[model samples]
Target: MKKYTADENRYENMQYRRCGKSGIMLPLISLGLWHNFGDKDNFDNARTILRTAFDNGITHFDLANNYGPPYGSAEKNFEKIFKEDFKHYRDELLISTKAGWDMWPGPYGNFGSRKYLIASLDQSLQRMGLDYVDIFYHHRPDPDTPLEETMGALDQIVRDGKALYIGISQYSAKETSKAAEILREQKTPFLIHQPRYNMMDRWVEEGLLNTLEHEGIGSIVFSPLEQGILTNKYLNGIPEDSRAATEGSYLSESQITTEVVEQVQKLNDIAQSRGQSLAQMAVAWLLKDQRVTSVLVGVSKVSQLEDNIGALENLEFSQNELEEIDRILKKD
Candidate 1:
């Protein structure tokens, strides 16, 4: 492609929020590479998505070691894109990657052992062609490993200069408190948490948000659209190419029940009344709460990314609107 130049006025429209009590200020909407950006996907589109995100002032880009269809491909692909387009603008970006899922074959390649966490980030750094990532997350809670061991590994990574900040993903409210305690004792810069929080998934609201606030840890929530269920893509029915129609996808067809479609339709009405798309409203709903530091949005197209960014236009909700949403969500 031709030479890329980021918009000079990118920061003017996008809203930035303080990440808990940290010096870091994250965009209200962050880009995620959970879907697309793999080896099998379009490379040019992926490059454009990254460019568009930065052009729109989305500084934070979230990725994981196992993000691609074949593990490690996303990082490798990102390395190429970064060199081609963002090499000079590296300081202007906030790049994050996680490791804690089934990455490779063997006992030492997975989980929260110091050996695994340390080795995994080393490999991730190598693949991404970076000395250090802006943030490195543990990806998930390891029930078998001790919390101290996991948090200690994170602390070591920061002290080793592998990652500037440490984060954890999908950890329960209780587990998050324990992890934060350990990191505090270690004096690590435990900056953030990544959780699956959306209108449909309210698990974070139970206590996780409270824990993050109390611990002074920011949260960048994933699956904010509930794997596309919160969007209008399935309002009529599951499209032939939708994630739900594809076998082995995280969102199964059965999960999109009649009740869900009904809920989405009602929710869509509210979105229209608010002059936003369902996807936009879904993101706004999360941003309505100050506890959520940022919303991690994964998109297949550049237009979707722009639409999500449009959520910054109207982040407010009337008291009646909030109760209506609660009532609709509570319906059977």
Candidate 2:
């Protein structure tokens, strides 16, 4: 790739955060290709969203091997943008990709084993047109493979200069602590963890957050709006374009219960008082904690991404407001 300097004036104001104890810095708002950048979607729209995101200082792009509808399409689409508008900004960007999910059939194809992780990452780089990923992840834990083996492969990826750092997503606190020890020995550190957490779904509060903090590993949460449940979009009914209406795997009709809608309404009022949308409020809430390096958000449009970028303007949360919001949530 050759140098094509982006309009630096466009993104000079967004916040940049450090990844835990590592020297690497990630933008406070990162973009995740888990949705929107799919094979079945419009490529031009996807490219616009990607460029708009980068123009707003979203330097980190999160991708996975099986991200697109037919699989690997997201990486391929990203490759197009990389070869075009983003070629020069490669050094300024922090691109990441993950494996550990179903990519191919047979035993060697998927899992947390050394063979699977290594092979999957190499293929991911080819798809994305990159020499190496800034951070490579085990998309999810492979229950069958030993944690030691998975950690070893991740260490080797760093040692081989195939990845700048390593991370695990959705692993338990116990599992994270266990892996931390193994990586420490090789001097290969895990940079971050991705978990599904939002105001509605606070599973990480159970233990994952503390574990990462204790181990000095940063975390970036996904589905911070609980697949848009925390927003007012579902309060009346599922819109035709909603994730639930589209039968998204992560969201379902049953998720939008009457009680859930009522809770979101209450939260919406709180956001109104704070002068922000439910989405912006939700994102700000996540960045309030220092242990969280960024919130990897997904969007379908450049305007939508622009609206989300607005959250950086109002990240402070008063203790009383947080307590009041928690009080409402505790009842459910």
Candidate 3:
């Protein structure tokens, strides 16, 4: 096949927001490679998703070391596609990868130690065939490791030029502040955070968002659709082809209770009333909060990407609608 050429007017309809105090502005919607783009997945489909994402001005691609089912295969697969398709547009993209989870079969393979993070990123860069990543994150907070050690390692990562910016994912508000202070003292570019935030999961609203705001750090939320529960696919009960129906899926069928389904149905009705799909409404709801820099959405197909991006079209909500949504979500 011929080399992939991106759409010249990709930025025309897409909106960009400044990432906190940073000069970098990410698209309203970013692509997350947590689900697909693995060696077990179809290469052609992954190509289509990447192409469609770039065509729609999604310059940021979020990845992690343990994203693939077998782990690290997603980066290998993406390296192939990126080298063939996106090598020329390197400067135009924000590529991020994370560590701090189980990766290899050794004591040093996990957590936020300086050794683990540094070695993981080196392997990540090698797998992605990139000299450096835009952002490298400590996938999660390490309860055992000293915060200074992790932050110092991140500071070192920036100084080493292995990554341009450093971030921490799944950290508590207190932890975020502590890490931010350490990174600030070290003069590291503590750019953004990756947290699982959605209409279903509002934990970030407690204090994480505020901490990020006060510290001038950006936030990119993942699982914006709550693993497809926010979409219309669950309105009539889980389809056999859905994620909930798959064995050993994170979103198990048991999680889809009757009451949860009822709430989603009501939310879907509200979305329809606003001329948007349930998934679109969910994405828009997150972006309506000024603290959110971008909503990280993972999709299996190109059509899903289009529908998710459509959330940017109508992000405004009236007071009544906000109250109604709050009422519906707060229900037991």
Q: Which candidate should be chosen as best, given lDDT against the real structure?
A: 3
Show where candidate 3 strays beyond 4 Å: none
Clashing pairs in 1: none
Which of 2 and 3 is the better model by lDDT? 3
Q: Could you estimate the TM-score for every candidate? A: 0.99, 0.96, 0.99
lDDT by residue (234-294, candidate 2, tens digit) is 8787788888877546788887888778778888889999999888999999989887889
Candidate 1 C-alpha RMSD relative to the actual structure: 0.8
Worst 10 residues of 3 by lDDT: 323-332
Tens-digit lDDT track for model 1 on 1-332?
99998899988888999998999999999999878989999999999999999999999988889989889999999999999889899999999999899899999988889989999999999999999999999998899999899999999999999999999999999999999889989999989999988998899889999999999999999898999999999998789999999988998999999889999999999999999999999999999999898999999999999999999899999999999999999945
Colliding pairs, model 3: none
Candidate 1 residue runs with Cα over 4 Å from true position: none
Q: Write the number of the candidate with greater lDDT, choosing between 1 and 2.
A: 1
